[model samples]
Target chain A: MKAVGLVAEYNPLHNGHLYHLKMAKQITKADVTVAVMSGNFTQRAEPTILDKWQRTKEALSVGVDLVVELPMQYAVQPAHLFASGALSLLDSLQIDDFVFGAEHPDWDFNSLVQAENKFESTDFSKYNATYATAFNNQLIEHTGISLTEPNDILAFGYTKAKLKSKLSVNLHPVKRVGSAYHDEKIDDTSSISSASAIRKAVKNGSAGFESLVPEQTAVDLKELKDVNDWNDLYPLLRYQLIQAPLNYLAQTYQMSEGLEHRLKQAAQRASDFDAFMRLAKSKRYTYSRIQRVCLYALLQISDEQMQIKNKQLYLRILGFNHLGQEYLHQIKKTVKIPIITKVDQKSRDGQLQLDYRAGKLYEQLSGVEQDMRRRPIIV
Target chain B: MKAVGLVAEYNPLHNGHLYHLKMAKQITKADVTVAVMSGNFTQRAEPTILDKWQRTKEALSVGVDLVVELPMQYAVQPAHLFASGALSLLDSLQIDDFVFGAEHPDWDFNSLVQAENKFESTDFSKYNATYATAFNNQLIEHTGISLTEPNDILAFGYTKAKLKSKLSVNLHPVKRVGSAYHDEKIDDTSSISSASAIRKAVKNGSAGFESLVPEQTAVDLKELKDVNDWNDLYPLLRYQLIQAPLNYLAQTYQMSEGLEHRLKQAAQRASDFDAFMRLAKSKRYTYSRIQRVCLYALLQISDEQMQIKNKQLYLRILGFNHLGQEYLHQIKKTVKIPIITKVDQKSRDGQLQLDYRAGKLYEQLSGVEQDMRRRPIIV
Candidate 1:
């Protein structure tokens, strides 16, 4: 049983994503495709606009054979950790090939794979210095090309993890199409747009985004009225900023020394949350990073908690089709953790309950009380 | 002469800047205003968009009575160095006060000054983490607020320098108006717009920037076509990236240890300068910091050079009115360094030649041809 793997959010599988799914089947000629996707949160350190289950169903309706949850621990992490978690899941299932998108589609992957395999472990003592020395060295030796954008960095992360895992899985990269990543401008050249561009258009109420996504995804977006958005989190963030001890703030993820004092000062002067963030921004810390740190502080994610929860854990099931059922049967004995298909009351551990509560909050924020019905396992 | 001192670039005095000049004089009730402007480069580590002479002439046309050139050593230094240089110039002229903009219009200058004065003796060793730690403690003790934004940090620098110099000059802060600093948005509420926004608009060919700047500055900008921009320096930066020793690169300004190796690897993989920078960026080091470091490396500014140039230096004159002349004469005997209004051709040394050469580059880049018959300095 030849099996291929994908790592994505699906968030609402668009036509462009479907095209990749079809092309993966045609090119790899694989019997099954398993998608290891984010559960509730996204890579941007924000809650997904849609629930994971809805996104899973969308993927299933498209061409995806099976959908497995990429546990929350890895989902919200930086690119490398996210990739490692997804790749580990696929490796455990004994998948043969992994596919992704790249700006330069014609670039050879075999050379990259070979380079990844042959990378040396040098002293990264200066790792905390001015730049990321070890990561760059590996990238240069592997691709013979530099990582330029966020997407490129992510691709490099995937490659690095593949190398570190010592897995023999083949790497496939498809050509990125249409709008450039973070390019808010709509293009008529191709019927594809980056998720960033789509999100921007949605937020700004800009025109020409509908044609870029699948019809069902658009419908889902339209029907989805309320969810936990940035604004909803602002008040909570503000309260946290006011109440959090300066020392405790320094312990949260991404909260460096001295930044806490600055944050504390800005909180007093700012009339609201946005004003506070604006005042807190500095040359070294980007606005996105500050926002993430603020969120983490609000959530009270301590240094010790972060240390323990940073690793990949159980593989939760979201959705699956007929082909997915067969693939699951083949790999059922080899899997490490429980592949949860239903919200089992018996399996609701402390952490799992917290995850479920987060999901419930997400549903309430998104204005979808009716969709809270427990989903049945297709398999 | 009761004069107010300004440390500025003028760089084509826009309307909002003109408003600042007018307001400073009106509020401070000063007879004259002197501006210590940059010779060629700016504090942000970029060359001025227009030549210094052109910028000086524009400043003179507005409310400025005198314009002095901030020596290159001071002009291109970091916030503390830049502030110290500007303060030294004002001190030499015996200016009574120094006025500037602050995000929190309500910032208390006396308290700030007191905090800065007390900081040196304070037990800052208890928070011996980074520069930010000691600075924040001072701010908290002074105003019970945390220091957050770049401008606030700069204000702190200015206050610290003023207190350390023991200059009897008062600190005054005006509330910034219109769009937020570095905000790309165009708001017509107030004429004030950040220099970053104006530069961005100019680069993108957007209109409505004229209203944001003074009329004279806009005319100067129109006259100065084909100015040397960052694009022209890309080749030089690329060469530096390629040839710079990994160890030396590590010592370049913000180039942390491990970052040098990352940069070295990136240089090898990147086909161009921009690609190299992108590859080198990470969560730890921002793109701006990287760009500044690259520029520092290109200029061969070592840690040793930085240490020597970190202190304040003498001032050079650009242009001045009658009142400014009176103000200069009053403190002529007490001034620390030679008030160089005219170039000393016979005494031109290596440093002077270097300064002159940088100025000449600015002239050439501004697309203005110099008349061979004209003297190097304009009276």
Candidate 2:
């Protein structure tokens, strides 16, 4: 009755993702494989190239037994909260082991976790950089090796989250293949392609995606009428920024250091989305941070709202096979919150409010209509 | 020293608008002509074809002495509030006369006003129609005139507002010409054209606009990158409609009669703006009504917010000629609310809040940049 779980975006459910899912299942020899996947929007505050439901269908078609939505509030955040949120969600399912993608799987987490605990606020105050940069600098100082690679950083976040949850789930790391996280160009590496490169190619209507993704995923990406991006969400984000006051924006999560003023000024004059991003970006704020801030501002995710821990959240099933259904039934009583396959007005509250807003906004952003009444895909 | 005032959209300031302005000045023999023009958004709850400053320049070039913004809270409203807001602002300026375009100039306002005052609310409750329809029916009952013509309705609203204001300003009605209000086709009629026709022609890149609009307007419109319509705004409106809860939507200014429910349902399935508008439109709610409510919802202009009368308003001049400057100088002490030419963080409040939002949203919708720091056009 061993269950293995993984956190992913599966933005297009590409070949690389399928490989990772298969690897997780085979290596762990687990009875059921669960994947906590991002919904419409992703960690960097960008909408998925394809939506959650479509990705779920592709995941089921590939091999994943269960696919549950990583509620949007957690999905479009920094690596830490994203990892924490996904791990927290998976932990609720009573899984025995959690597998993850990592740049360096053999990194000493025992010492790394101890070092993170020993890191002092006083020692980090010398650098005028982001918390991530400061932490990376600290890691570099400690081990003469920086944990700045996307997977390494995320793996560390996952370890920290696992520590926080204090769940019985054992952590397992599998070496990642393919291009680096931020790699913009797709190489001739046959099957393992970065999701970012795949998205970039799909957006500009380029070829070479066929070899990188699963047959279903390749077809879906090629046929996707609206590949959600900042360009599509720009108008809405601009509207939100302009309509709301600076003080109101200031209340949004991560809208500190007088960023509200900069956002307002940028939102006022920037002609389009790219222009706004450039205008808002500064030496102090990374483009990704600005993007997340903009998303937070749009979603009205205030600092107070972010501070309030989303303690009770239901597992929203996207798709499942017979094994996954059996796993759900076996663990039904032990599961924390209710497992929701379909939603109505009555069942929406807490984290679900933000999730619904982000989901509905994705519909608007993509110009795609989703049926709320549809049952989870069973294959 | 007499000044004649007119309230208008002057969306692009075409030949028809110029003709009306000249007639207003000549017919009244007023030394100064004051135009309380709509800012970024218009009476139909649509973004202007051009920004307020651009429209101001066109208005000044076409012989308007002064252009004051018709605060957004009022501009994108029904004829009654549009007329009332304009009249109230003009009353503050102590304008000698107000000129307006009308389908019928000789309509008996005295008896019509009396009939309007005498109309019982309970009598209209039996009809199960809109308040506008009920009022029009009541008017037809008394005067044997349907009072359904666009200009005629606006004229009636102006008269009612004038009565309410109890201002001593003389009301002058100028004859309207060329295409009708909702006319979509560009007719062979020279010079005077319907604003709707001009907009349609401009939107679809149709010919005959050169003959209809002024040389400057035609030139500006030709170079215009984006003349926003429902399509450009569809994403934001759809996002606004879908993201918000039905109960939350019910509190919007025009969300009544279970319209919130209809809006949510329509938003979920409608693929685009036009589809959403069509799906949302009902027998009880006219297309214009639906558009306005969508706007109100997007702007988050609530029923309570609308109830809170925006009392303290300043005359934010868009442009002014020497005569207009002189008039302002002479009446500087008497002018109500501080006349703001340059705005700062401190200046953003009350109706100005809404006006700035509407103006800034115009920039986003149009993909046009406007320098707020630059002084108004002095022609």
Candidate 3:
């Protein structure tokens, strides 16, 4: 059976996302497609607009052949780690091919992947000292191979991970059509935009977003009563800041030398989370980074805990389509670790408890508790 | 006499500029205001929207005490050089005080100036290399005085120039009111914005720009039938790129190393100036820098010529208010060069000819020929 693998969040599958899946199927001519999706949180360290089950069900109903859960550890990482986690899962599943979008898709995929793989060997210690430098160095290294472009960098990561795992999967890249990845403007002509743009459009109540997403995804979003954002979680963040010991607070993600002291001092002075965030942000730490760190602190994710949970372990199932079920059955015999679908009392171990707690927080924060209790939608 | 020095381009006196003049008068309580205005080109290396005569007249009509033109050498420079030229001119006039707008008006001016002066002493070979070092050094030097901030940097430049020149003028910074310098949104609360923001608003044809500029300036701008930007100059830039010898092209302002070779090759292959610029621009050379170099190439300005003209000489008059005449007369004996009030064919020298050519180009490109020919509007 010709099988293709997708790495995504599907955080609430939109129209554009559905179109991508449909296009992937048509272009690849694959019999089955498996998606590795994030659980509660996103890369930006924010709760998803919809519950994971709803998002998973939505993906299955649309087109995905199989739906596998991306662990929380991988879901909230930067591009490289995220790709590593997703590719590892797909490798274990014995997927035949991989597809992704790129601004310049006409470029050669194998050459780009090769270039990216070559770049990993070069020591970029000088440039890696700073965030921008490290990012640009990675770009430069990949550029040696045809994949030196921005979008290709992510694709290159996936290819490199696959190569490392000795997974035999052909790479397919679709030309990214429509507005820029982070462009806030809506171009009615092509109507495709990055998820960041979609989220921003929704938050700002911008017109034309309805046309951007898939029709069903738009309907689902519209049906949802509450739309939560970072600002809404300010009170929770404040509680976390006030309650957490200094040592625990200092160990959160992105928290660096002496920053915890400043954060602690600022938290004491400020009445709200916004004020504390504003006070804590310096030239070195961007507002977004601070926000992520704050979320990590709220989740009580200490440095030791993060170190232990840094790597992907098991693929947790969210939802799947008919083709997805067949692929799952086929992979179950060969795959590593448990492919968790249902969570019972026995499944609530240390890591499972953490996942459950995260789910509870997500449901409470997003006001999607009723949706979570509803039966998972099957294609 | 209590005299205040103004550093400006007076690119046609707008309403918001008039507000600055009125505020300066009230705050400084100066008997006379001396304006050191740009001759033809502006700091962005672009021709002023209007000719110097029309701009001077508008300044005169408003409240300027004296109008002295800043030499073209210093006129089209970066922020530091631009500030130096203006400060030197004000120093030459032996003005007692200088006033400028700052985001945080309450910031300590003297300490900031002291820090800037110290920062300039460290000889750094590479650009932006010493930026952080100089900044931290300045902070250390000024410990217990005041914290270093961004807005203070510009104010500090003025102070340093004055100190270096041994000028008697005291620096006075006014708190900036209204919209932020880089604010993209139109602010209805205060109808004032940075010149950059105003230009963007006008270019975008966004509403509420009418409130940004003076009524007379707005009327003057409206009378100009066409507004041409870089796109319109593309063909001209492209032609210059193709015609100029590679060696000669490299001598243009901001052109460095083998960029001229790159430009020459790009120009041959690209359809237009924009395409050529895009090809030439890399991580090292910014788009704005490339545009300036292209302008310099179009003007046939050589490195030798630029070197010779590095030092500011003659001040070209534009327009002035009632007090401006009295101030001009007061400093007439102390002035180094003969100020040109009207363009005389017999008396106009090489620099004046070049200035006039730049003005003519501005008129042609901006489609403000009729406006250019009009008698100065003495306010």
Candidate 4:
């Protein structure tokens, strides 16, 4: 019952993801494939095109053996934490290999990690630039290869996390086959489009996106009456910023250096999320960073809570096929952490509180139950 | 310039309120009429039919010489607190008389207040009943009367507040005219109807409410698109309750006796405000008490902040006429507290934070600017 694992967002389960899944099985030659996917929110704190369950069903339909949720505390975070959290869960599941996509899959990420280790810790203290800019500055000077693209940075993160955690799983980085991550428009001739491009096509009512996605994803997109984006969630964020006290907001995860005051002022004056972002954006912080902080504030996740929950890891299964069930049976006793098949009162309130809260927030947008006694999908 | 002060919600200024205003002028024989009105929200923690500014315009157009906003801390509170807060502001303005409506104008409310003073302090500790129910039990035993009618309860509160604070203003309890306070429909024969009945008429699209309200109120009601109520604000409440931690909710004003757990649990299960209320309600807490607590949670208001703001009272002018201007000038020298005409940065972030937050929440429904740099209406 050997298994290979993949970490993904599978935002809408496009052809790009299908290709990656196929490559995972081909590259590892494992008996079963297990994927740790983000729950309702992505790493950058954006709501997924489809919910975790819907995405899991899509994954199972496309021959992925098992789908487990990457807990929210890990999902809506920096790339390093997201990569580390997913790898930890996969390692616990005793997966033999981990597959991912990167812009430069052949680059020696291990050397980049070693180069970063040599940089002074105080390099992150530069107040005039963002943390990524500071890190890239050092990287380009040492290795002559700056990590700028999304997957490239994530690849570096995977290498760093693997070395630090001393996990036994092997890492495989395959070349991303289609449209780049940031490409917002779908190419009419291609069957593999980025998730963002598919989402954009759906938003604009453009045709031909059906070819880029699986049957399940196309059906989900057709049923999606409204795209769950910042535009729809801005009112809740604005209300939180305008109402929560400065001291309380200061305690939010990653809220530092009097950012609470700046955010509170912006929420007061800005009429929408874009206007809020424009006002809140600064040289020291990226738009994604501020957006993640806004999500933390909206969910009311505090630094103390995040630090506490980070230590309590779990594998929350979302869906599984017959092979996945057999793999789970094989590894049931050997798994180091809890494997939750259904959400009960104890887990929903205790270890799973963060993900539960995040799911409730997403539920407000999707009008679908996220957790709470919901059983994993079996194909 | 002698002034008679009235306390009102005036959710929408109907003919009943107009008659009350005329009666105040006739009975007090004052040179000017002033009103300390609830802003945006009512005593039951419900959003008004119209915004405070619109209601103020209607008040001034109907010869309410002056209108002052009841601060959020006092506006959305229990009857005693709301009565005391409004009376304190009116007393600061040096009014000659305080007038309000009551179902039993001739009842010995001062005696009732004195009788309440004689009850044992431990009487309120009954765990099986609400504070109001406990107080009523004592009242029924001592005075052979239960203060149940809304205005009668307010009248008792006014008497208690006036006696306890030793205010110099005269107390005038006018007989309430027209529809009963809880009546949901307007009677065709009477021009004077309750504000609730008018709001219901507007909600149901039942016409003929135009004759019940004044010309300005009729115009305001005619232009009303969606009636703002708990139905619209429930999402915000549900989000706050479900996302905020128990300790944070426990700090909410009047959220006592482990009610935070009840509210948080109810928010997790209930999809609407009504369902949330049903789950949250108990024998020990009334609907209004729970509703006010919900508003406090939505605003993220803490008990300590409420206590601090309770002592720092201010007179915020909302609108005025020529006579009202002269009266303000007359009291400008003698007034003990600061008078705010426009919301500056200091006040918006300090003294007016709660009101500003409430206004912002209401603004989401009405699509009108609430408080920043806006001038008071002049008639």
* CA-lDDT, candidates in order: 0.66, 0.79, 0.65, 0.90
Write candidate 2's Cα lDDT for B66-155 as tens digits.
889888777888887788888888877779999988888888865687787666674434776776788877777877777777777788
Better of 1 and 4 by DockQ: 4
Q: Runs in model 1 with CA error above 4 Å?
A: A105-144, A226-228, A271-274, A344-354, A367-373, A376-379, B1-379
| DockQ head-to-head 3 vs 4, winner | 4
Residues forming the 10-long window of minimal summed lDDT in candidate 2 chain B = B365-374
Ranking by lDDT: 4, 2, 1, 3
Q: Using TM-score, rank the candidates from best to worst.
A: 4, 2, 3, 1
Candidate 4 at residue A275, lDDT?
93
Docking class of 3: incorrect
**Residue B214 CA error for candidate 2 (Å)?**
3.7
DockQ for all candidate structures vs. native: 0.01, 0.52, 0.01, 0.86
* Strongest candidate by TM-score: 4
Query: How good is the docking of model 2, as DockQ?
Result: 0.52
Task: Output the better candidate (2/3) by TM-score.
Answer: 2
Predicted candidate 2 versus true structure: per-residue lDDT over A131-183, tens digit per residue: 77888777777776688888888888888888776767888888888787788
Question: Chain A TM-score per candidate?
Answer: 0.84, 0.95, 0.85, 0.98
Candidate 4: the clashing residue pairs are none
lDDT of 4 by residue, A61-99 (tens): 999999989999888888999888888888988999999
Tens digits of lDDT, candidate 1, A148-266 = 56655566667777777788888787766556676766666778877766766666667776787776677777666554556665544543454334665777766775777788667
Candidate 1's DockQ: 0.01
State candidate 3's TM-score: 0.46
